[model samples]
Target: MTEYMPIMLDVRDMRVLVVGGGRIAGRKARQLAEAGADITLISPEAEPEIRELEAAGTLRWLRREASEEDVDGYRIVYAASGDETLNERIAEAARRQGALVNAASRAQAGNFIHPAVLRRGRLIVTASTSGAGPSAASALIRELDERFGDEYETYAEFLYFMRKKVRETVIEPETRHRLMRKLAETDILDQIRQDTFVPWSETEAAAWIEREREE
Candidate 1:
């Protein structure tokens, strides 16, 4: 078994092919499209939700069985026809075309694998068992979701804004890192989760920066 090297690819404007119309295929296609890929789904028939996306012009839908020709021009290919044999065959053709292929039934057959993910705006947490156990990864993700509430997304965005400002304000690189780390370790996340946080104000951040400079 090949060890998977984890990566978060930016699929924006990349040509992605999904060669199945089943629910799992549809879900994977939707995630690709949501990430700004130019998605083309080739399946004789697709799940209702995927068909709806086609209707909405979110993706190009080829209402036909996948052929070798369908693999051309795709940067990424997802083989998810639910037939393990067919998926592997599709994976073979896609790899020949120099496309990175992900087969639903067989992780080792593909160059890449997906981890269970939780997202809150710019914040994303991923759980993976290194292809050892997907169900365990999913369970771990669910547990993390319980621990990190939706408010964490807002917390992430807030930190993004502040961190950028800190970079601009704190001229010293080491000082900026210390200030950012200090802010992250504070009770802010807890306060947000408990709904006891004052409406976020840059005033507190400014004060903290000043105090850090003094110390």
Candidate 2:
């Protein structure tokens, strides 16, 4: 068994082919569409959501069964036809053509597995069970969703601005490290949970750092 490695792909404007028209294919198509991929779904039948996207011209629809040729000129291919034999053929074709393939029916058949991911602005958290139990992975994602609320989102944004400001204002490397250490020790999330404003300004962050050092 191959060890599953986690990675994020930049799918913007990439050509993605989804071989299926059922619910599974529709779900995959929707996700790829949301990621700004040029999705082409090949299936004889489509779910209601797929039809809506097709009608709205958000995605291209081919009312025909998938073939090896469908993998051609595509950056990524997803085989979710629910047929083991068909999915295997798709995967083989994608491999021979040097295209990345994802077989939703069998994770072992594909090179990668899609993880349950939650995104908040620049913060992205993903969970996977190596394709053993997708349901369990989904459950874990839900649990994380409940435990880590919007505070994490705000914290990520705060860090982004802080890093940029540090580059612009703090010239000394030692000074920058000191400031970052102080920010890390201040427990900004705890303060946010306690209903305090997230201090993003240099002066506010410095004050919080001083208070933490005194404690």
Candidate 2 residues 39-67, lDDT tens each?
99998889998998898787999998888
Where model 1 places Cα greater than 4 Å from the true spot, the runs are 170-172, 202-207
Could you tell me how far off, in angstroms, the CA of residue 122 lies in candidate 2 after the best superposition? 2.8
TM-score of every candidate: 0.87, 0.83
lDDT of each: 0.87, 0.83
Instruction: Assess candidate 1 and give its TM-score to the true structure.
Output: 0.87
Give the per-residue Cα lDDT of candidate 1 at 89. 84
Stretches of candidate 2 above 4 Å error?
A: 167-182, 198-215
Q: List the residue pairs that clash in candidate 1.
A: none
lDDT of 2 at 34: 80
